[model samples]
Structure formats: C-alpha cells, structure tokens
Target: MPPIAILVALADPTRCRLIELLQGGPQPVHVLAAAFRISRPAISRHLRVLKQSGLISEKKFGRENRYALHPGKLAPVQRWLAGLLPAARITEAPAVVIPAVEQPLPKARRIPKPAATPVILVPALAAEAAAPAPAKPAVSQMGFDF
Candidate 1:
C-alpha cells in the first residue's frame, strides 16, 4: 500500500525478472524456471517471494500451476510511480490502466540466526566434585560373594 513497501517488494532482482516474464502471459512454474538459468526450486522460491509481495498470483489448472501478473496488488506501486513520474513516461501501456486482480502478498518470514554457544557456570571437575559417589555394596565374609 505504501511506496516504500512496493519498492521493498520489487527490490529483489529475481522478483523484478519474474514480473518481466509474467508480462508476456500466464505461465507454468516449470516453463518460467526453464526460461531462466537457475534451478526450478530457486525459481519457485523467487515466485513465492513475488507472490507474497502481491506482484503475482498462482492457480492450479489440471496438472499445472499457472502464474500471472496481478495489477491490483501493484496499484500502490503504479500510483507511487505516477506521483514521481508522469503516466505518459511509462513506455508499455496495457488496455486496462491497471489490472484489478488481487495480488497475493508474501507472508512475513522469520530467518533464524546461528545458535550461540552455551555458557556453563561450573566446570566439569567442579560438577563431579559436587555429586555424591555411589556407596559400595556390603557382602558377608563368605567364599562366594553376592
């Protein structure tokens, strides 16, 4: 909705390229990935980010998943651009001023940081010293020990 948010969404290079590709028409994930040098999984991840950002939308049709540009999600972006630069400056113009389809925004993902080393208050020797030793079993003075 905000200009900064839109800019942040499009900041990723992969996402920018994805938007460019979707401009052509709706395409399957495999087709989109095959067009790029990166692996399909990588492309899928990029698409996931783009989808989360509301730049794209996906649908399952039969055996394939199709993705297309969602202009509604990009309204804030176009509006932001329109403010900074005049509409006439935008070279590529589609029939609709902006597609009204809803763009799926990506979820807020948390990236886990590396685990820190645990600090032990007491030394191993000190711990052993603090522990009680097991008592020896008492046996009768007999030839066979119990």
Candidate 2:
C-alpha cells in the first residue's frame, strides 16, 4: 500500500488500538468490537479503513470475517524510521549552559521630617458611655426572638 494511506490508517486512535489488538493474531469483527465501548458498526468502519489502507487484511471464515495485521505492508515506514534511529540513540549527553545575572536593588531615599501637631491630655470617658447596652433576654411561648 502507499505510505500515505498506511500513515492515515494508523493516525486514528481506534485504528491504532485495533492494530495493537491484531498484533496478538487475527480477530473476528465481534471479538474486536467487544474490546471497545463503541458500537460494532463503528469498529467495523475502523477495520474497513485499515484494510483499505493495506495495513490489515481480512479473511473469510465460514460466516464470519477475521482481520489480521499485515506487517509487510509497513516496510517503507519501518525503513524510514530505521534511518532516524541512529540520531535518536544518543551516545553523549549534550552540554547545557546557564548565564549569570546580577541585579541591584534601588537604594532607600531619606524621608523628610514632618511638622509637629500640639497634643492635649484628657481623661478617658466612663465605661457606660463607650459600652453599648446588653440585649434584652428572649422569651418564647410561641412568641420567640431568634
């Protein structure tokens, strides 16, 4: 199959999971659908896409159809990825440098003296004038204060 179609087939989450499931071996449509919460038709649709892309192949068995992964069809993709593997497998760690920074806080300014205000001494008021009266006691009969 074309590389683009293969990639498109694997792009979907459902199809990717289906591929993972198929890796164990071939599976019938109902068996694959049982693995997902979605309707059986939805699973079939994903399988159809995978089969059309040549990422998978379907076989006839009595009355049922079984789908299996076609790993051979992924040769181009595997080779392309193999080419990138050399760069991905690092032998030496890359260097990292952090530059030093010097920050100076602003100096405090001298505050000017304020003009003085005159002060007079007075005796504090008696407690009764400053304190509020206590609330009246609540009485309940059917008449109640909350």
Q: What is the lDDT of candidate 1?
A: 0.75
Runs in model 2 lying further than 4 Å from the true structure: 84-86, 89-146
Taken over the whole model, the C-alpha lDDT of each candidate is: 0.75, 0.77
Cα TM-score per model: 0.54, 0.55
lDDT of 1 by residue, 53-117 (tens): 77788999999999998766776777766777784454446633223334566789999998999
- Model 1: lDDT of residue 34: 68
Candidate 2 achieves a global lDDT of 0.77
What tens digits encode model 2's per-residue C-alpha lDDT throughout 15-104?
A: 888887887788899988877777998999899999999989999999999998887787777666657685664342333322223356
The candidate scoring highest on TM-score is 2
lDDT of 1 at 76: 73
- Candidate 1 global TM-score: 0.54
